[model samples]
Target: MRVVSRLSRVPLPALAVASLVLMTVALTLVFYVAPNDADQGFSQRIFYFHVSIAFTAYACFAAGAWKALRHLWKRDPGADLESYVAVHQGVIFGTLVLLTGSIWAKISWGHWWLWGEDELVLFLVLFLFYCAYFMLRFSVDPGPQRANFSAVYALFGVVLIPVSFLAIRIAKSFVHPEVFTLHGPNFGGWILVTYCVAQAALLLLAYTLYRVELTGKRLDARIRELRFA
Candidate 1:
């Protein structure tokens, strides 16, 4: 497999500092600026970060799947690493989705979990599916073959997203008599601005984390070669 001689030359400290500032500001907006939702009240506050993160996680997974496809079809070496890191971030944020979703469910329904909540139920399946991704990663010896297999499986995950969502929706027929809306702040005025800022900040943070982790892993590979050479 081919390797990159050097990673991109962006300043690490600057990236970290910028992401910290963004996170701080975004959290403030999420809690203080966004008005109390009429339907869900205080619990609706969690929706900002929770939904943003969930959407971001989906983006990451889609990105990973795209890279995986490139790796498999085009034989692009760097795609493998990029695909791995993206999926890794997807898994992290997916876990957060489940965590925050559970919190919201508890606040609203007095239960930590509800199988009937379609979005939450979908995330639960995604969470389990992606968790197994790590198992697949660890079980394989690192090589082109491992990369190829991971790529193929990641593609499967993307396909599974819609399938799982449909399955959850179908299951809801027997689970609940009426659908309960997951209330969110109206997309107007300051609420709109807050959601946009929060989303931008979260996406920037995900990118920063992805770059740093990718760089670190690449450096580790270089170090191993130096030590053994």
Candidate 2:
């Protein structure tokens, strides 16, 4: 709790600057430093961005669910808004996952989308399910009822994360190309370094955006209270 509060106090500018620097470094590593894959060739470069964004989306959704749990179980005063902001960020990143996945698919499989792919279809389902969260959240009047509804929905939606993540492995049908196989990771060397950098960059970017949105919403609430007063 103390740590979280301290983190919340981190300056937005610092986070924004860190995100920008890391993102530039990650891009450089992805394009210039990472060697071309023998199998997928240059097109494999998309994996760095696509997989990192997907993982970041997962992190955001998981964070939202954790905040929602705090709101419901602990009755944390600020958790509701935090959960909403996290989920909103998740949706934004999820959209990127879809777009990048589509591009990867086009390059690898010669299709914009592959319905036969378990991972792709499951991710789409997860994305659409969360998309409904906004509708559910906005339908109720602001108060405890709205907060309760949102919290519960967030909790329910989070269940899909693991399911979607493991769909490729579990499904008997055609699966998306598995980067991490039972034997070991399919690629190594600088590819792993590039992936790690990309993941860090996207997570930092997501956190910066989450904090910015949360701060704006809190300010809006304060302004509303002042007007009412």
Candidate 3:
């Protein structure tokens, strides 16, 4: 309880500053310290940022689902709005995943888009589904029903994550005869450290953005209340 209270009271500016510093350090490590892949050469550097963004997108969706569950089950105030904001962030990062992955694919295979890439295809499906979530949310009046509906939809996305991963695994046997491996058996040392740093940077960046968005939403609501009062 004390830890939670302290965390809640921490200034957003301080948090943002910390995140910026950490991300800067991580990016430095990625570009300067990480060794070039012996196989893919310089192009392999893209994997650090691309994979990190994908994982962050997954984290955002999971957070949104958890917030949605809180809204539905615990009736936590502001949980619905928080959930929506998290999902919005997820979509933004997911779009980045598509763009970065496409660039990486083109670099590796001389094609911008590959029809047989299971991970890419699965991400596309999830992206489309979550995009519709916003449309569905705004189509209804803002109230308990809207909250309930959005919560249910967000929950469905959680279930879809594992199912989609499983489907991708199954597709590898047929659609993709050759397995795609990002890291080699020799992946370690500075390469591992740099990858971990990059991953942390992305997660921190995502959380920082989420906090900023949530703060904006709260401020908007407060302004509306003041205007009405």
Candidate 4:
């Protein structure tokens, strides 16, 4: 029971501090330590963080969906909250992907945007879809009904990831026949170190944010209980 209770809660401020440290280390390494790839030059460096972040975001959403499944399937009381926190983090990183992808597109193709980039396009659709998840969450009153709907919708979002990727790939064929391939910069010892630091930092930062947001929500719930009591 003690272990369960501890598992149910997280130390938010400490996690936040650790996340900050990791991010700082990562950025420093990315700029100073990592070497540019010979083939892709400077732009190739972006892939180390960009693609990693994208994959991380996907992992988070998938995690949320799994938790949601547990919540619905096993009736785990903690599952819904855990799922919500994970989804929230996923959306934040997903936004980062769009921003970074746009920048990368400009750097690579001399355009601020390109729909032919399957990853970028796929993220845009996902961002919109998940944004609606929050909307649907708030619009409906809080109860089992809300939880049920959110869980089911989260499941849908997970399915949409691959479907959206396929859609973008197919759309790109007619939309932009010329496929612009992207290759990351050639990195040396320092650059490689920096990218690893950055990736770790980003992961930590995501977890920190998740913990903080979850804590705030839990406090709010507690306060509501007190007031109602």
* Among all candidates shown, the one with the greatest lDDT: 3
TM-score, one value per model: 0.91, 0.90, 0.92, 0.88
Model 1 TM-score is 0.91
Native-structure RMSD, model 2: 3.1
- Give the alpha carbon lDDT tens digit for every residue of 156-229 in model 4: 99999999888888888889999877644455577667767777777777767777787788899899999999
Provide the lDDT at 207 for model 1. 75
In candidate 4, position 224 carries an lDDT of 98
Better of 3 and 4 by TM-score: 3
**Which stretches in model 2 have alpha-carbon errors above 4 Å?**
1-6, 164-185
Per-residue error (Å), model 2, residue 9: 2.7
Tell me how many clashing residue pairs each candidate has. 0, 0, 0, 9
How much is the lDDT of residue 97 in candidate 1?
A: 90
Comparison by TM-score, 1 against 3, better one: 3
lDDT of 3 by residue, 96-177 (tens): 9999999989998889997566667878999999989999999999899999999999999999989988988887888878
* Candidates in descending TM-score order: 3, 1, 2, 4
How displaced is residue 52 in candidate 3, in Å?
0.9
In angstroms, the error of model 1 at 203 is 0.8
lDDT of 4: 0.83
lDDT of 1 by residue, 1-229 (tens): 1222232355777778888998899889888888888887877878878888999899899989989999999999789999999999998988899999899889998999988788788888988998898899889999988898899999999999999999888878877868777655677987788888888788878878888998998999899989999
